[model samples]
Target: MEIELKPINIIFIAFCNNPKCKNTISIDVEEDTPKDDEITITCEECGNSIRISYEVDTI
Candidate 1:
C-alpha cells in the first residue's frame, strides 16, 4: 500500500530593518516548509532578521 500527501501553498515577505539598508526580499513556498509554523529570514545586506507567519489552504 502507498500513501499520498497533499500540497500546501505559502507566501513570504522579507524586508530590512536597518534605516541605511532598506532592502526588500520575497519568496514563495516551493518544496517544503520551514521547521516550524513560523519562519525567520535574515537580511543579506544588514543581517537583520524578520519573522513571518505561514498559512496553508485546502481546496
Candidate 2:
C-alpha cells in the first residue's frame, strides 16, 4: 500500500514579551518557503524581537 501527502501552510502569531509593549506580529508560510524554516520578527510598538522555528514530522 502507498500513501500520498501534501505540504501545508502555517501561520504563526507572536506577541511582544515586553511588559510595556502590547503588540502582536503575524507571520505566514507559503508553498514557496521551506517547511522547516526559521523566522525573526521585531515588534512595531517596541524594540522587542523574537525568533521562531518550525519543524515538521510524520508519524
Candidate 3:
C-alpha cells in the first residue's frame, strides 16, 4: 500500500494575551507542513508574546 501526500494551506488565528493590547494576528501556513504542535508569535502592535497550540487526532 502507498499513501499520497500534498501540501496543505491553513489559517491560524491568534490573539495577544495582553489585556491592554488584545491584538489579533492571522498566520498563513503554506509550502510545508508544521513540525511542532505549538506556534509562538509576537504581536506587532504591542510586542506581546502569544502561543498557539493544536492537537491532532487520527481516525
TM-scores of the models, in the order given? 0.61, 0.72, 0.66
Q: Report lDDT (CA) for all predictions.
A: 0.71, 0.83, 0.73
Selected candidate, larger lDDT, 1 vs 3: 3
lDDT of 2 by residue, 1-59 (tens): 89897887788899998999889888777768876778888888897888998887766
Q: Which run of 10 residues does model 3 get worst, by summed lDDT?
A: 28-37
Model 1 residue runs over 4 Å out of place are 1-11, 34-36
Clashes of each: 0, 0, 0
Candidate 1 lDDT, tens digit per residue, 1-59?
97777675655777777888979977676656643577778788778878877656544
Lowest lDDT block of 10, candidate 1: 27-36
Candidate 2 vs 3: which has more lDDT:
2
Candidate 2 versus the native: TM-score?
A: 0.72
State the displacement of the C-alpha of residue 52, model 1, in Å, after optimal TM-score superposition. Answer: 0.5
Q: Tell me the spans in candidate 2 whose CA falls farther than 4 Å from its real position.
A: 1-3
